[model samples]
Target: MAPENSNTEEVVVGEEVGRVRLITLNRPRQLNVISSQVVSLVAGFLEKWEKDDDAHLIIIKAVGRAFSAGGDLKMFYAGKTDDSCLEVVYRMYWLCYHIHTYKKTAVALVNGIAMGGGAAMAVPLKFTVVTEKTIFAVPEATIGLHTDCSFSYILPRLPGHLGEYLALTGARLNGKEMIAIGLATHFVPSEKLDELEKRLVSLNSGDEVAIKAVIEEFSLEVQPDEESIVHKLSIINKCFGEESVEEIIKSFEAEASREGNAWIASVLKGLKRSSPTGLKITLRSIREGRKQTLSECLKKEFRLTMNQLRSVISGDVYEGIRALNIDKDNSPKWNPASLNEVSSEKVDRVFQPFEAELELNIPPEGDAYRWSGKYENSVYPTLKGKQ
Candidate 1:
């Protein structure tokens, strides 16, 4: 365990078990939230392991109820006024990109809450193991932030318009649901994770197929529950597939009016309550992500994040955090208070490219790794009246 500070708490612990390099997120009290220190430490470890010939496999897990909640919001809150936080964001995204294109086989054992930045860590790995305790979501929109951390690339590849629904609504998915959606590769019961880890270490070899077989031995055959939102794919595609956020909400409104579905009503309520500008920005990013490669998506997202942090268009992120975390009040007075007030030009401004020197320095496409998952084409039925 490497101590990050004078507090004697090792925020990230790394050790080798045979040929396996294990990384444990050790901040239980903080729900293993990713801080600048955490990103730097993990990135450093990955860089070292990538070169070490003895390291054949990498496994990332956490010590608390949360694998990782997300990026350190308090850090962002503290560095709200200056470009001081950009370095962390740059490094975090680069870390994510490195993991995405990692040379060695990698696995993420997610047994707890994995949201936002946490999801980024797990989803890009070659294999991800989840347990019943795993909870996943990309809920940046709810906090007046666009869905980021390379999700713009990942989400659009899910079957149908599920990505749009997730990005806009911040819907939470359990372990079973995650596997069903191809977001996770295996589902092991929480009780068997330790045994599975030991078995993995005993192999002492970096054969991908062998590693998968061992994981499968401990994994369970599970399915999404009857009440899971995944079952509502047709409705989701019908509603979220719309070109504009306003039109998407309108589709939901139409569905709610026609069927009076409690689910649709709840979705409508959630969308209405979220930041109008965030919804617009997130929707555009997800759509653009459909054609862009992983690197392109990250670059685009970096611009959006920087713009939001710089308050290029508005300071809704700060307001959102202040309302949710600082004041503990649910009410966030979003600028351009309604959807109609959020103009297309304003949305475009958020996605505008930064100058050459200020942009994220991602490695070229040929050097970066591409996801091997079967990316289903995101096609949706045309809305009745809208194009």
Candidate 2:
């Protein structure tokens, strides 16, 4: 329970209803951004509910038009000069891991905009219910940060080279596209969400089958629209499959010249507008993610995040935030200015393992930490394994 206040300023609100434990992101004005406070509250609720015998299911939803816009970049910007911000990143990633390995079933009702940390919270759950109003993206690279919040593990597991494409380009995926790509488990119309919630609470059981059955009743068979970038899988696979960021841009450039595709041109422009160093680092992170376990990927991402924030290689993140958020200039002056100038050595240094004490300490996965989503089985195949 939150402390009583005249303002009722709770960023997150939680309650136990029947057999269901519901967590709501309450800070609509802030887009329910994942501040340190938000992380602490949500993590505490999840930990508490996991131990509650009366709690059979967990449902996470948010008020307003955005599920979460991402972590508080302004907060990050404020703490950029010191290690003060790293604690939040550490705790947030830990929360992400806990959700991934949670014992009981959890569902995210992402009925609005879900980006970065928002998408992080939803996608890893046992079931992610998206609606027509849902808009999802991992646009971190544009801000000179890598896609994170266990996305390193989740994204690489997406079908074809879709993971790389999304990570590199910060592409947006609609509800139908999310379902098609296995990022979402169900698509329920926005209007039925309330009824669906009521039905779920009535179940009062964590039985995956029972819960899934109820959800399926309202779930629609949705396909990505004809104009969805999801349909460009073949081209996405070919272009993003290249060994390097340079190669990827080159491939897109070649494709654009040959086909004169507006989409391809847009991709190329996005690449050109992003920090060269960010593109390189993000590309490597997603590639490494393919071979690493979820735990390993989180650790590596922790390192990358720390290094980026600390400006081990460059201060592109700061510049990016300044240009986009603070200054609203929409023009960032990347240190290396171009992809060719971002050396392999600098990128490697960013990924180097942190000191044992500095590393993220993730708990070992329990048997209950398994994924059974309809699309995940085919897209992810296995969650365990080093190779």
Candidate 3:
């Protein structure tokens, strides 16, 4: 292993078990939320570890109430400039890509909350060990937007209409629900999470085969029941298929009206509660994700978030944050108060990256959407609604 660097910000790293390298996020006060510095440190450590002969596997866990709360909002607030957000988004994109494609198996020991970008990073790992306290979500919908990264690629593939369901509501996935819904690979008592990690490290042959064997034999794997999928498939598939956000909302409302489906009704409530501008942009972003490669998606997200922060152009981001986070009003004074009031100009504005010279680390002349070796269902659904 490379000698420890005293100045490194990546907290801790060392071979925990034969070849399992442990990466514990260190910013406990912020619940280990990733910052610009953390990103650089993570990039350096991951790159070095990937090249080192001593590191065979990597396990990412945190030493706080959350695995990570996601990106540092403070950084965003400090970086009101267009370039500030760009650099931050670039760091996130590269860090996530490194994690997803790492040659060694990566495990996420999600002890508590993992939401938005945090969930994005954890979901792609080979094994996500969740404890009873673990909760996962993408609450960007509540903030008047959708998540970037590969959430588009991973969420819909989840059990039932869980992806879209969570997408619309900003609802959280509890540990039990996460496991039952095919999100968590293993579920254990919250108190035993550390012990379980130790056990995992102790095992010999800690390769994929060994990991799978332990996960199957010891952990209570709450596999998603296919019946749940079939039940919601009809509504989700059709609703998700709608061409626009307006159409999808109308479809959801109409479906609820006609059948009194509790799920659809609840989703409709959430739709009504969200920022119209955010919802429209989110729809566009999801559609963009279906076609773009990973890097392209993140680049698109970077531009989208920058557009979102255009305080001079609109009241969406500031008002949304103030209402949702500052005052906890939960009722934002949106620039365009109604969904019908949201215009094509507003929707289009959110995706327009300000700079002309911005570039992405697109793979050399190849399709960017190229997902590494497929697991099962990685494709974004074309026939949508809830499915």
Best by lDDT: 2
Q: Per-residue lDDT tens digits of candidate 3, residues 1-387?
A: 122332245454434456666677777778777776677666666666676677766777777688887767656655544444555565676566666666677778888989877776677788887877787878776666566556765665665455665666677767767776667777767676666666667764438877777655546645434433335667876676687778887787777766537667666777787877777777677666666666566667766765676553355766666776567777788777888888887677667764533434433333354322221122212212222
Candidate 2 positional error at 205, Å: 1.7
Candidate 2 wrongly placed segments (more than 4 Å): 1-8, 365-387
lDDT, residue 107, candidate 2: 90
What are the RMSD figures for all models against the true structure? 8.3, 7.2, 8.2
* CA lDDT, candidate 1, residue 368: 38
**By the lDDT metric, which is better: model 2 or model 3?**
2
| Model 3 stretches astray by more than 4 angstroms | 1-18, 81-83, 156-162, 180-182, 204-206, 223-233, 258-260, 263-266, 311-315, 352-356, 362-387
Two-way lDDT contest, 1 vs 2, winner: 2
Q: Spell out the clash pairs found in candidate 1.
A: none
Which tens-of-lDDT digit does each residue in 311-379 have in candidate 2?
999999999999999999898999989888999998989999976645677765554433212112222
